[model samples]
Target: MTTRSDPVPRTVPPGMADGSSGGTVPARRRRRQGGERSMVWLYVSTLVLGIGLWWLASALGDNALAPTPMEVVAAFGEGVRDGWLLDHTLASLGRVLVGFVLGVALAILAGFLMGWYRLGRGLLEPWVQFFRTVPPLALIPLVIVFLGIGESAKVFVIFLAAFLSCVIATFQGVRNVDLTYLNAARVLGAKDGTIFLRVVIPASMPYIFVGMRVALGSAWATLVAAELLAAPTGLGRMMQAAQQFLQTDRIVVGILMIGALGFLMDRLLLVAERRLTSWQEVR
Candidate 1:
C-alpha cells in the first residue's frame, strides 16, 4: 500500500520517437529555400562582376572606343529624356510581337500537318529545308523589292526567321513523341483526334517551347538587321546613326538595351514553359 502502483512507461510512435522522420520534411524545405536564395545571389553576383570587369576595362583603356559604363548610362538617360528611346523600343517591340505571333501560329499549323501525315511531310519537308538553310537576312533584298523598305519588309524578315525555327522544332517534337504513350492511348480507346490533342500535344510541348525560344532569338536578330538596313526608327536605327557619328556611349546603350530586352523575353518564355510542363520532370 505504501509503495503504490508502479508507474506505467510511455511509448512514443516510431518516427516521432526518433525525431528523424518528423524533422526531415522541415529540413528538406529549409534546404530548398537555401538553394533558391543561393541561386538569386549567384545571379546578382554575376551581373556585378560583369559590370565591374567592363568598367575596369573602360577605365584602363581610357579611349572613346571603349566608353565607360557611366558614359553609357548618361547616354541612356539622355535618350530617355529625348523620348527617342521609348519610341524606338516600342517600334521594335511591336514588330517582334506581330512577327512572332504570326510565325508561331503558322508554324504550328504546318508542323502539325507535316508531322501527322506522311504525304504532307514528303511535300513540305523539302521546301522547309531549303528555306531553313537560307538565312532570313538573305531574303531582305527580295522582300524589300516586293514589299518595299517599309514595315512590311522588316516584319516579313522577322516572320521568316521565327517561322523557320518553330516549324523545324514542332516537326521534330511531334516525331519524337513516345510510341508507347500513343499505343497506350489507343488501348484506352482514345480516338485519333483525342489522342493527338491530349497525348501528342502535351508530350511534345517541351520541344515546341524549345523551338519558340529559338525563334524568338532569331526574330530579334532579324529585326535588328532589318531596322539597321531600312528602319527610320528603332534600336538598330539609333545604333546605326550613333555609329556614324562615333557616339560610342549611345552605341553601347543600344547594345545593352537590345541584350536586356532579348533576355527578358527569353525569361518570360522559360517561365511559361515551366508552368505548362509542370507535370513533367525538368532538369
Candidate 2:
C-alpha cells in the first residue's frame, strides 16, 4: 500500500513570519515617532518666527502702543522681582481653579440627569439654551451688582461661563451614545444602572472632556473681563492698569502670561483625556 507523503511545511521569511518585519510595523512606528518630533520642531519654529516678526515690527514702528519682545521680557522680570506677577498670577489661578471645579461638577451632574431622563431634559434644556445664548460676559454687571465687587463676583462669572459651555457639551455627549451598545447590554440581561455605568458613561467621556476644554477657555476669557472691570488684583487688573499708562511692555507681558497659562491648562486636560480614554483609538 502506498501512503501519501506529508507536505513540507512552508517557511515564513524572517520578520515576515509575524508580518511585523517587511518594514510594516517597525516602519509605522518609526513614522509616528518622526511625526511627533517634527511637530515639536514645528511648534518651536513657529514661536521663534512669531517673536522675530514681533521684534521687527516693534523696532520699525518705534511706537509706544507696541513693545519689543525684549522690552516685554524686561517688564516681566521687573514684575517678578517686585512680586507683582506672582501675586496676581496666584490670585487668578486660585479663582480659576475654584470656579472651574465647582462649575464642572455641577454641570456634569446636571447634564447627566438631563441627558438620561426625558423629564429632566424637558425641564432644563430650554432654560439652558436660552441662557447659553446670552453671553457670559453680559452677566458680569448683574453678578457684580448682586454679589458686590469681590472675589465672589469674579468666581461667579467664571463659574457661569464654565457651566454653560460644559453642560451643553455633556448633554449632547450623553444623547449621542450609540443605541447599539445599549441594546447589546440589555440583551446580556444588564439592568439600566449597569448599562449606564458601564456603557453610557464611557461612551460619553470624550464629549465631557471636550466640554471641559471649552469651559476652561471660557473661564479664562470671562475671568479677565471680570477682573478688568472690578477686581483689585489679577492679571486682568494688571493689564488694565498698564493700558491706562501706556505701559505697553507690561501689557504684552500680561497677555503672554494669560496665553501661556491657558495653553498649560489645556495640555493638562489633553493628558487626562488620553489616560482616561485609552480604550478609544487615538487616530
Candidate 3:
C-alpha cells in the first residue's frame, strides 16, 4: 500500500510542459547567433592584423615600392577628387559586366549541348580543351590583330577567358548529375524537356554557380591584359601609367580597387547561390 502510494507527479520544464520544442529552438537560435558573431569578429580581426602588418612593412621598407597605407589612401582620395578614378572604375566595370554576361550565356548553351549529347560532346569538347590549353594572354596578340585593339578586342578577350573557364565546369556539372534522379523523373512520367527543366536544371545549379564564380574570377584576371589592348581609360591602364612614372601609391590604389571590386562581385554571387540553393544541404 505504501509503495503503491504512487510516484509524485514529475515537474516539467516550462517550455517542455506540453512537449513543445520552444526552449530547444531558442537554444539553436542562440547558437546560430553566437556563431555569426564569432565570424564577424574573425573577419574584423584579420582585417586589422593585415593592416597592421602592411603598415609595419611600409615603415621598415621606406621605399617607393612599399608605400604606406596612408599614402595609398591619399592617392585614392586624390584620384577620386580628380574624377579620373570613378571614370576608370566605371569603364572597367562596364566592360567586365557586358563580357561576363555574354560569355556566361554562350557557355551555358554550349555546355548543355556538349554535356547532353554525344555528338555535341565529340564535336565541341576537343576545341574547348584545345582553347583551354592556350593561355588567354597568348591570345591577346591574336585578338589585337583581329579585333584591332579596340573596345571590341578587350571585351572579346574578357569574354573568351570567362567562357573557357566556365564552359568546362558547366559541362562537367551536367554530366555529373545523379542518374538516379533522372531515372526517378522518368519513372514519374516526366518527359525529356520536363526533366531537363525541373530535375536537371535544379540539380545542376550548384555546378553552374561554381562555374559562374570561376568565370567571374577569370574575367577579372583577364581584365588587366584585356585593357592592355591600347586601353586609354581603365584601372589597368591607370596601373600601367603609374608603373611608368614610379607612382607606387597610385599603383597600389589600383590594385586595391580591383581587389575590392572583385571581392564585392564574388560576394554578390555567393549570396545569390545561397538564396537559390537553399534546399541543398551544406556544412
lDDT of candidate 1? 0.88
Candidate 2: where is the Cα deviation over 4 Å?
Answer: 1-31
Model 1 residue 110 lDDT score: 84
Residue-wise lDDT of candidate 1 within 1-283, one digit each (tens)?
3775888787765556546566665566578679989988999999999999999898888576878889889999998999999998989899998999899989988888899899989999999999998999988778877998888888888899999999988998899999999999999999999999998899889989999999999988887798965788998898899999999898888888888998899999988998899778543
- Residue pairs with colliding backbones in model 1 are none
List the candidate 3 regions with Cα displacement exceeding 4 Å. 1-34
lDDT order of candidates, top first: 3, 2, 1
For residue 258, model 1's alpha carbon misses the true position, in angstroms, by 0.9
Distance from true position, residue 193, model 3, in Å?
Answer: 0.4
lDDT of 3 at 28: 61
